[model samples]
Target chain A: MKTSDFIERLAEALDAESSELEGETILDTLEGWDSLGHLATIAMVDELFGKTVSAMSLRRCRTVAELMDLACGEVTP
Target chain B: MGRVLEAQGASVTAVAGYVPQGRLCNEELSSRYPEWSAEDILRKTGIRTRAIAAPDECASDLAFEAAKKLINREDIDPEDVDLLIFCTQSPDYFLPTTSCILQERLGLSTQSMAFDLPLGCSGWVYGLSVARALLEAGEATTALLLTGDTYTRYVLPEDRNVAAIFGEAGAATLITKRSDLPGHGAIGPFVFGTDGTGAEALIVRGGASRHPQKRRRLEMDGPRIFEFCLRRIPGLVHALLEKAELDLDDVDLWVFHQANRFMLDRLRKKTGIREERFAWRLEEEGNTVSSTIPLTLESAVVSGQLKPGMRVGVVGFGVGYSWGAGLIEWTHGGMQ
Candidate 1:
């Protein structure tokens, strides 16, 4: 999946209707980006890609960029 | 003219259940994580403990197992069955109905009327009403209605708001075309009501027309859900009783949706129904969503608490902010 597509999906998953999320936008910055949203993100990733990310793997990432990198297999955390 | 079949005469053939391997109770989860609490879980949603589904298990998996068990009975001809219904808010997938998966697994006749009922907690009664209608219409001979939901899949463990109240489970009941002796009567005019204005009160933010799964995760308004339950259930109960032409005392048992201890107690007082008239399994099974009512029925029968010829008032109210109730009279030793 494309990084842009993942970002868009993340935005939709967080219920962020219309926000220009730049590269610098924090994952938790969006409204309703709570624990449920977080788990949904992980679930989406797992469902799309054949991999599992523990709660710790998500907790270690600080921003959306890190998550994208992790999703792409470029970073461990 | 076709005779109306009464619920009291019908038999519950079998009941089977499934839960996620990972188990977490309110106190255990609370003590493990300082941020969560028994009271916090209660205030958010009046649930003491809830079950989470295993990573590999899906809604259909649980449903299929329950149906399989119910079908295992020698009296049920698996090949001759004509209907399969799944009732739950948590489905295996958004598009293909979970019943399809269960239908395939159960090796049911391809011609069976297969579908899923996307309902909140009040689904069991809702499914029962649908099954009764189908049976009365003579459209199907044997119908399998399963209520299986994994609400924990929608919420996070840290969400004491929901973590404390929900339990994952599946229960199935086999309704057949049998008209002899006590097996036939009136299911009575069913009573159902909804408040879409309070829709936000008990909703999983993701996975539906309004919120859509692609949009977000489940988010619920705890106090609003509690208030909705407290304010509306008693009125609905009285109205349904009026429709059935029966007094509260005439009802043998009151099986309210097992939302929580607090909510059940509050509703008991408001409805002016004595606590003894109510049947419950909240403490042992937690809240098993739509499965609560049927599972409680099975439990009551096994424990010798309920016997044949007894009438019970069954009601459910939750998520979707929906409410429904039906009066059923038990037919003991009826299931072969």
Candidate 2:
């Protein structure tokens, strides 16, 4: 999947506007960045990337770029 | 001492399930938890109503009802059943074992073999394997595999996560020596797996000896459990197909544990099984733990979705984080 698509999905999962998110955006600061968001992110990654991002690795990601890195196996261009 | 590698000739002769009279519909649940609307619950979980057990009912009671119905419907004499296997996580008693009680309650002969196999979710498949093993070993001929769980008993009213997903039910399956037919139905070439590491993902961590006095209600990590399913199910399905030497296209039906509609849809898409081939019956009865597969199998048969000679791929996953998959050659006519 495209990096842009991934970002858009991450924004959707977090219930934020795509324009409001960037690689540096902090995850927990978002209103919807709770367990449901976490689950949605996992499901989105699995569906889009056909890969399971390690939940542990996912939790350690504090920013958008870090999540993209883990989910995409390094941020896609 | 003698044992044979070939599983003895066995076929599922009858299957029946019973759900208690009580029902907790999505409307009622949403009224209680205003944060979730009835539409959202049904749209997300594919479950609109959940069967709840009566306050005084036990898993054994549910199992007995199902078993009695099966025995009468199949016209099998209780004395003819030489082996009885009751699979449940909620047994009537931890001491005497629930199967012993069932053997008497169901009126099997005193000489019959009876025992409890405490398992959840993956239990019916596991129970089938055990009964087939015993029958093949000549330890028992006609066998009864009973799966019942009142998991609602473990659900606390406050926890909507599990309460929204689980339903109380029981199923009875009769396994007997295949009659003299050239192409008789068979259940086997099974693939089973267990990951104890995932135990905490869905558990009631309080009542056991380790924390006997702490009595905590059932709690589930939805994300964690869903992740586990996402990771493992594809492999399990592939392995079972390989073991059976059948291609995915050869399977006439796919009946996975009715975890929920969302998970089933994901698994179907991930595994590439056709939507028409998949059994999606959880809308009316939420996840019924061990009874889900048998109950769904029977439902399919009664509705004519399953027929004689059809190859049905069945798998059960959850609870202990245990899973098993196998192919069943459907034989019962009218599947009645």
Best by TM-score: 2
Query: Which residue pairs does candidate 2 place in steric collision?
Result: none
lDDT of 2 at B197: 94
Cα deviation of B66 in candidate 1 (Å)? Answer: 1.3
DockQ (C-alpha based) per candidate is 0.02, 0.47
* Chain B structural similarity (TM-score) per candidate: 0.88, 0.96
TM-score of 1: 0.73
| Per-model C-alpha RMSD | 15.2, 2.9
Worst 10 residues of 1 chain A by lDDT: A46-55
lDDT of each residue in A1-77, candidate 2, tens digit only: 66678789988766679988888989988865755567678877888877877666677999988888888785345
Worst 10 residues of 1 chain B by lDDT: B3-12
List ranges where model 1 is wrong by over 4 Å.
A1-77, B1-14, B32-49, B182-186, B207-215, B334-336
Q: Output the worst ten-in-a-row residue range by lDDT, candidate 2 chain B.
A: B1-10
Candidate 1 DockQ score? 0.02
